[model samples]
Target chain A: MNRLGLGGWAILVLAAIFFITPLVMTATFSFWEGGDRYGFDSYRILLHSPKLFESAWLSIQLSLASVLALLVLLVPAMIFMNLYAPRLRPVFEFMATLPFVVPAIALVAGLSALFTGPEWLIGTPFYLVVPYFFLGLPYAYRAIDVGLKSIDLDTLTEAGQSLGASLGQIIRLVVLPSLRSAMLGSALLTLAVVFGEFTFANVLLFHTYAVYINEIGQHDPTEAAALSVASFLLTWAAMLGVLVLGGGRRPAVGGR
Target chain B: MRSPLAVFFIVLFLAVNVLFMLAPTAMLAIQAVFDDDGAFTLEYFQALAQYQYASSFENSLILSLLSATVGVIAGGLIAFAVLKDDAPRWLRSVVTSFSAVAANFAGVPLAFSFIATLGTLGLLTKLLKTWGIDIYAAGFSLYSIGGLTLVYSYFQIPLMVIIFFPALEALRPSWREAAENLGASTWQYWRLVGLPVLAPSLLAAWILLFGSAFSAYGTAYALTSGNIALVTTEISAVLSGNVVSEPQIGAALSVGMIVVMVLVLLASNLLSARAARWSVKS
Candidate 1:
C-alpha cells in the first residue's frame, strides 16, 4: 500500500478548491430556490423562456454553418500550402494564428467599424458567424496542421498523382479520411467556441446562446446560473465524446 | 512542379486572413490616427494618456502581470507534480483535458460561476463568514481588482499546465540523470539545468497568459459589472455603447491593446524560437 505524499494530497485538494468548487457552487446555486428549498425551479424557469430556446437554437445553427465554412476554408488551403507552396507555410501559420492575440472585444470593435457603411449587416445573425469563424481559426488550423503533418502530405500527394488520381480524389479519399480526427476535432472545437462566445454576438446585437444567457442573468441570476452549468457541462460532454469517438490520439493543442 | 490552381488557393487563404483579421486591425489603426473627417490626426492616441485611458491601461497591466506570475507558479507546480512526480493516471488525464477545456473557456459563464462561488452572497464567502471572517467588512469586494485576479488565475493555471507541460516533457530524463551524477540536489538540478532550458518558453507562456488576461472582457465584465476600468471593458464599453459618439476612441483603445500584444508577442516569438533550439535534444 503506497501512501500518497503530503504534497500530492495538497495538489489534489487545491484542484478540488480551485477547479471543482466553483463548478459545484454554481451547480448548487442553480438548484437552490428561495424559501429554504432546493428544486428545479431555476432550470424550469430557463426552459419556459422562449427567448432562451430560440437563441440557443439559432446559436446551434450558426455554429454548424461556421464549422462547415471553416473546413471549406482550411482543408484545401492547408494541404495545398503544405504540399505545393511549402515556402509559404510559416506566413500562412502566422496569419492564421495572429488573431489569437486580438481579443474578442477588439475584433468586435473592428468588425463593427468595418461594417459601418453596411448598416444592413448590423440587422441579422448572418454576419456574426464571420467573426466566430476567425475566433476558431487559430485552433482549427493547428488541429488540421497536426493532422496533415502526421500523415506525410507530400508522400500521399505523390502516390495519388502517380496513380493518375485527381486532386478531388486525393483530398476526399486520401487526405481527409487520414485527417479525419483533426477535422472532427476542429468541428468539435468550433461547436464549443461558438456556443460560449459572447462579445461578437452581443456587440453585433445578435441573439446567440451566450448573449441570451447574459440577458437572462440581468433579470434572474438563479436561472442564469442553472443555464450556465448546463451549457458548460454540455460543452465538456461534447469534448469528451469527440475524444472517445476519435479512438486514437486526440488533437493536442500546444504539443509539437 | 506545382500547378497554378494550388497557387490560387494559397493566395485565397491569405486574402481571407487579410480581410477578416488584418483589415479589422488596420481599421483600428486608421481610426486611431484619423479624425472624424478621415484626415490623419493623433488625437485618439494622445487621449490614451489621459486619466480615463491611462488608468485603465495601468489597471490592466498590473492585473495581467500579477495574475500571470501567480498562475505560472501555481500551474508550474501542478504540472511538475503531475508529470515528474508519477501521480495517479486518472489525475493526469483529468488535469490534461481540463486544462485544454478551461484554456478555451472564457467570458460570461466563467465570470458568473466565480460570482456564484465568491460574490457577496456567494458560497465560499458564506463559508469564510461562518469561520468568523467577514470579507466584505474587511474591505474585500469580489468586484475589485483583487477579486478579479483570483478569478483570472483559475484559467491561467490550467493554461500554463497545458502549454508549459510540453517543454517539461522535452527535458530529457537524461538531463536529470546527468545532474544527479554530478551530485546535484533536486533544487540544484532544476535551477542549473531545467530552469535555463525552460526560461524562454516560460517567459513566452507568461506573455501569452498576460495578453490573454489583459484583453479579456467577459469575466471582468460580469464580475466587476463594468464598474471597473480594465482596458478590455473600457474598449467594450465604447463599442457596445448605444450612441455612435466617438467610435474612434474605442478603436484607439483597441489599437493600444494591439500594440502591447504585438510587442509582447514579438518578444515571445523570439524567445520561443531560441528555446526550440534548446529543445532539439534528439
Candidate 2:
C-alpha cells in the first residue's frame, strides 16, 4: 500500500470517500430510530408502503421494456450501419448524440407539449418508456457500437453469408456471441439509465423508483435515504454485475 | 445492405428518432418563438433582460465551466491511479464500472446523498465543524452555485474517466520509454509529446463536460429546491407555473439553453475534427 505512492493513495482515498460516504450515511440513516435509533424499521416501513412496491415494480418493468425496445431497435441498426449503410453511419451517429445535446428538462417540456393534446398518454408507464428509450439511445448506441466494433463485424457477416448461413443464424450464432460483451454492457447501461432517471419520470408524472424516492425524501428522509441506498445498490449490482460477470477475460468494450 | 428486415428496422428507427428526437425539438423551438396566440414574437427572448431568467443563464455558464475544469483534473488523476499496472486490478475494474454506473447515477437519490454528505446539517459538515471549521457558517451552503458545482463535478469526473479512459488506455507505455530513450525528461516528454497528443481531445472533453453540466437539471433542482436559478431550474419554474406562468418563456429559456449547447457542440465538433488530424499524424 505504501509503495502505491502518495498520489495513488490520495486518489484511492478520495474515491472511497466520494463513492462510499453517501452510501454509508444513507444506510445508517435509513435504519434511524426516532425512539431508539437502529433496526429493520425502515425496511418494515418500506414493506408497508405499497406505493413503493408499485413504483419500484413499475420502474423495473418499464426499464425491461425500454431495454427490450433498445436492443430490438438498436442492435439491427448497429449491424446494418456497419454492414450496409457506412455512408449514412455519420448521420446516424450524429442523431444518436442528440439526447446528450438536448437537456432532459427540455425533453420533458417538449414531450409534455407533444402530449398536451393526448393527455392520457402522460399517465401511462409505457409512455415513459418511449422517452426513456430515447434517453438511453446515446449510451446504448455508443456501447453497442463499441461491442460491434470490437470484432471484425463486417468481415464476419460476409463470411457467414458466403457460407450459406441465413441472416437469422448470422445474427444469432455469428453476431450475438461475438457482440456478447457489448450487448451486456449496453443492456446494463440502458437499465441503469432507466432505473436512475428522474427528470422525465418526474415531469411526465410517472412514478419510477427515482421519482418515488424523491417524493419519499420530501416526507420521510430516513426511509428515503434507505431507498436511495437500495437504489444505488441496485444500479451498482447491475454495474458490477456487468463488469465481473459479463466478460470472461478483460472487458473489450470498456465504458464509453 | 438492403435486406427487407434491416430496411424495416432502419425505417422504424428513423421514424422513432424523428417522432421522439427531432419533432419534439422542433416543437420546443417553435414554442420558444411563438405565443399562445400562435403568432411570431420575440417577447420571450427580449425578456431575457429580466433578473430571474438572466441570472439562471449566467449561473449555469459559470457553474458548468468551473465543474468541468475541476472534474477533468480529478478524473485524470483517478484514471491514472486505478489504471496503473501494479495497482490492484480489482480496483481498476471497479472504478471503470463505477464510473459507468455513477455517470448515470444522478437526479433525486443523488441529491439526497449529497445532502447527507455535505448539506448544512450534513455529516461531513458537522464532522468538520468539530475540527474548528464550520463550513456553512464560513458561507459555504449546499444550496448555492458552489454546491451545484460540487454535485455536478461528482458525475462529471466519472464521465471524464469514461470518455477519456479508452484513449488513455490505448497510449502505450513504450511512447514514454521511446521519449526517455531520446534523452527526454518526464516533464519534457509530456510537454513536447504527451500534451500535444492529448491537447485537442482534452479540449473536446472539457466542452463535452461543459454541455453535460450546463443541461443538468435534477441534481440542482433537488439540492436547492428551486433556490438556485440555473437555466434548467428557471425553465422548470416557468413550466410548473411558479414565478412566471408563461410556458412560452420557459420554452424560450429552453431555446436559449439549446442555442448554448449547439454552440458548445459545434466547437467540440471542430476540436474533434482537428483531433482526428492530430491522431492521424502519429
Candidate 3:
C-alpha cells in the first residue's frame, strides 16, 4: 500500500505499456479487417487450415516426446549424481549449459549440417528431437539438481534399503515423490522450450507448430498473428500452471 | 541377481547421449579448419575477412554491447524500485510477473508487434501523419539496426530485471541504513556500498545479455530478412540456401560464434565467483 509520487506512477505506467504494447498490437493486427472493422475471420482461417491442426498435433507430440525423454534420462542420472558423484555435479551442469550460450540458430545450423551431410540422420525425427533435448537439459538438470541439494538423498536411500527395497525401487518410490514439484517444474519448462522452438524445426523443414508460424508468415500475416497469439496463450498457460503447482509445495523432507 | 544386459543398456545410452551432444559441434569445428581442397588451411578465415562477415561480426559485437549496457542499467533501476524499496504492492507484483512473462516473449511475434506499432501503417505513424508530420520521411523506420536494438531492449529489460531481482534482494537493508545514519548521501551510499556488492551480478547479467543479443537470429532475421548482416543470420543464410555451398565456411562462422559466446561466459563465471567472494568478505 505504499504510495508513489506522480512521476513514479508515470514511470510504472510507461513500463507496463511498454511491456503490453507489442502483445496488444499483435492481437489487434490479427483481427484488423484492412480498414476500420474488426472480425474473427483470421482466427477462423487459422482453425480451418488442416495444416495448422496437423502441425499443432505434431508440435504437441514432439514437445511431449522431448519432455518424457528428459525425465527418463535426467531423473536417474540426477539421483545417482546426488547420491554418489556430488563433486562432479558442476562439470555436468557446465556441459548441460553450453547450448544456452550458443545461439539457437547457430546450434541448429551446426547440428543440421552434422546430421544432413556425412552423418545422414536428418531424414529421421531423432535429429530434430536431439536439439530439443539439449534445449531442455540445462533447465531440467538445474531444477532437479536444486531439488536434490535441498534433500537428504543418502538417508532416504538408506531408509528404503532397510525396507528391503531395490535401488530402482528406492529411486522410484522415495527419491521421485520427494522431488515431484521440482520434476514438474523442469518438465513444464522443457515442454515450453520444445513447443516454442522455431530455429531447428524451420531449418530442418519439420512441420512443427513453429514452422506453421513461419509458413503462415509467408502467405498470410493475419493467420500468422493468430498462431502467434495461440503460442503466447499456450506458453503463458503452461508457465502459470508450473508456478501454481510448484510454487507453494512444502520443502522436501530433510531440506535446508 | 545378474543383470549385465541392464548394465550394457545403461552404458550404451550414456555413450549415445554424449555422442548426440558432442559430435555436431566437433564436426563443425573440425570442418572449419579444413578447406574446399581437402587440405587444412585458414582459407575460411581468410574468406571471412574478405567477405562482409568481418563487419558483420563487428556490428554484432557493438550492437550487443550497446543493448546489454542499456538493458542492465534499465533493469537495475526497475529491480531496485521493486525489490529494495517500499514500492506499491500492486505495481511491484505486476512488474515482477510481467517481467517473467515478457522475458520469454520474443522472436518473430516481437518483431511483428514492433512493426505494427512503429511501421508506416502503424498506430503512431497514423497519429503523427494526422498532425502533419511524417515519421518515415523524418528518418524513423523500425527496420534498421538501431530500431532492432530498441525492439530488443523490450525483452532484454525484462530479462535483466528478472535475473537481477534475486541479487538485489540479497542486499542487506542494514548496510543502507548504516550509510544513512552516517549522513551519507544516496549517491555516496550507492557508489561505496551498493556498486561493489552488485557489480558481479550486474556483470554476469550483462554478459548473458550480450551473448543473447549476439546470437539472436530469429528477430533480426524476421525483421531485416538477412539484409542486415549479423554473424548468426549470415551463417544461417549460407547453410539454408547453399549460398556458400562450402560447409567449411558455415562451420567456421558457427565456430566463431561459439568461441565468442564461450569467452563471454567464462568471463561472466569468473566475475560471479569474484562477486561471491566479495559478498562473503563484506
Badly placed stretches (over 4 Å) of model 3 are A1-7, A117-121, B1-14, B278-282
Residue by residue across B185-261, what tens digits does model 3's lDDT show? 87898899989888888999999999878887667777777667888778877778847557777888888898898
Rank list by lDDT: 1, 2, 3
Cα error of candidate 3 at position B90, Å: 3.3
Q: Predictions ranked by TM-score, top down?
A: 1, 3, 2
Question: How would you encode candidate 3's per-residue C-alpha lDDT over A126-201 as one tens digit per residue?
Answer: 5677788888887887788778878888887788888999988877777788889988988887787687777778
DockQ of each: 0.55, 0.56, 0.46
Instruction: Evaluate candidate 2 and give its CAPRI docking class based on DockQ.
Output: medium
lDDT of candidates 1 onward, in order: 0.82, 0.80, 0.76
Better of 1 and 3 by DockQ: 1
Error of 2 at B123 (Å): 2.5
Off by over 4 Å in 2: A1-4, A150-155, A245-256, B84-86, B130-132, B278-282
Q: List residue ranges in candidate 1 displaced over 4 A.
A: A1-4, A117-122, A245-256, B1-8, B242-245
- For all predicted structures, in order, the TM-scores are 0.94, 0.91, 0.93
Query: Which 10-residue window of candidate 2 chain B scores lowest in summed lDDT?
Result: B273-282
Q: What TM value does model 2 have?
A: 0.91
Which residue pairs clash within candidate 1? none
Clashes by residue pair, model 3: none
lDDT of 2 by residue, A1-256 (tens): 1136777889889877877777777677777767556888888989899999999889889889999999898888778777777887977888898887788888878877666656466556788877888888887888777777777876777888899998899888877776777777778777877877887777767788888888888877777778878877787788786676556553432222
Q: How many backbone clashes does candidate 1 have?
A: 0
RMSD of each: 3.0, 3.3, 2.7
> In candidate 2, what are the lDDT values of residues B110-190, reduced to their tens digit?
888888778776667877988999988889988888888888877898899988886676566778888988899878977
